[model samples]
Target: MDESFVDGVQGKPGSGLIGNRKFVISKKNLAAQNERGGEENIATGWHAIEFLLWGQDLSETGPGDRSFEDFVDGKAPNADRRRQYLTVVTELLVDDLAGLVKAWAPATKGNYRARFEQGGKESVRKILVGLGSLSRGELAGERLEVALNSQDQEDEHSCFSDNTHRDAVNNAKGIENVWLGRYVRADGSTLQGASLRELVAAKDAALAERGTRQIAASVAAAEAIQAPFDREIVGAKDAPGRQRIQKTIASLTQQSKDLVAAANAVGITKLTLVQP
Candidate 1:
């Protein structure tokens, strides 16, 4: 599914950007080929969907220049096939999310829910471990640091749509949700419960408040970067582009430290900020 096809089928209104058939590669098709003892490049997932929807970001001025006629009937070759592929991937994504929702439900018959329900202290530890690890390692290190260091557009989380800024902010929000013990669903409903913030507040109210403020600061810093992240990492260290990246990194690093302190305040004595 080419970016143009995605835009077209989604009713964005435009013609296909490039008429090449090579971009229609489907992961389901690739899996079938693999099962048949054949090798096919597997490049399908959220990023692939983004690529199909936004194509490649070939300019600093904007996102991929894909048009929308690729999925209109009789407008482009294999338009129907492109539509079918998009439908398949979209359905699969929804199904996967449903599975996660089921697993995380309070009454879920799974280890994930069971472990959290075992005890309040156990739950707190699990939550802080996840929060600390995500802030110090995955979100800060892998997502932000790796992309900034490499200065590669392909390394951008949503390079095609130039939406990595959203990724960073949302990631911070996720951390905040765990701390506050709340999550909003797609239908505008929220799941609320005891959270790390509540736990830490009981032990040390000031620390909990600090953690909350730090999380907000990090989110604000990330959202303040004016350019797409890929473009922000394109110059010398002291350049304005790199300066924006550094500011966000500094904010995340401080928040990570605050998260670690919050964990400690809640009695996680051996909690390590850096995880393998």
Candidate 2:
């Protein structure tokens, strides 16, 4: 999904600096293409919605400033198409998510959830792999390090909305939730139970404690990076914002190592993760 968004923005930026398809691609061409949701090199998905909502991020200290009037038919170019595209793409996203929910539903008799519950060690390994991938390869590397190294505002994730800071915070929070086996519902309720932390603690209590602390440190550092992640990656090498981001990156890196240790503690010897 992210790859498709990148291809669209960087390659076929059609009508606007953000975009409005070059030409509408049919659903037939999109089949068998998971995450690669495009034909004729068009962009769709989260970034497309973001582009429509907030054009290009031309400002130095803020995000794109697309006006609501743009969606008011006849007030802006491609207003009708914009509305139609939004509806279609949003529905597709929701549909895809719904499928995932059903697959993971606890009550499902023979879905992925059932298979996973019986997977045991393999399931635990998969969980650690996913956490490792997200923490190091995705969040720390592609999202943070890329922008930090480039110092280009466009490199920032969710650049259209200046929400990269929140992205990092939320991602770190997700890792924490999984480690602690806790989830907070939209209704302000939280669910907690046995988790990766407990599993690691069973073998090595000190390692579990270290992993928890490191995860918390990463969350704190990510939260401290401030809004407008573009700004945080710019200025002098020792700038406060830059330093904050660096700290977050460092914390995330260390936590990835801690996660590897946690995995090993749980008897998963084959710990393989992509370099961030």
Query: Each candidate's TM vs. the true structure?
Result: 0.76, 0.88
Off by over 4 Å in 2: 1-22, 25-42
Candidate 1, 44: how far from true, in Å?
3.7
Candidate 2 TM-score, true structure as reference: 0.88
The model with the greatest TM-score is 2
Candidate 1: C-alpha RMSD after superposition: 6.1
Each model's lDDT:
0.69, 0.78
lDDT for predicted candidate 2 compared with the true structure: 0.78
Model 1, 1-276: lDDT tens per residue?
Answer: 233433333344343322334544354553342213221122344765676666568877678755677668887666665666666666666776787777778765655776667767666676677887787687778778877888887677677888887888888888888778899999999999877778788989999898898888877877776657787878888978778767877777888788778878877766665642
The Cα RMSD in angstroms, rounded to one decimal, for candidate 2 relative to the true structure is 3.7
The candidate that achieves the highest lDDT relative to the unseen native structure: 2
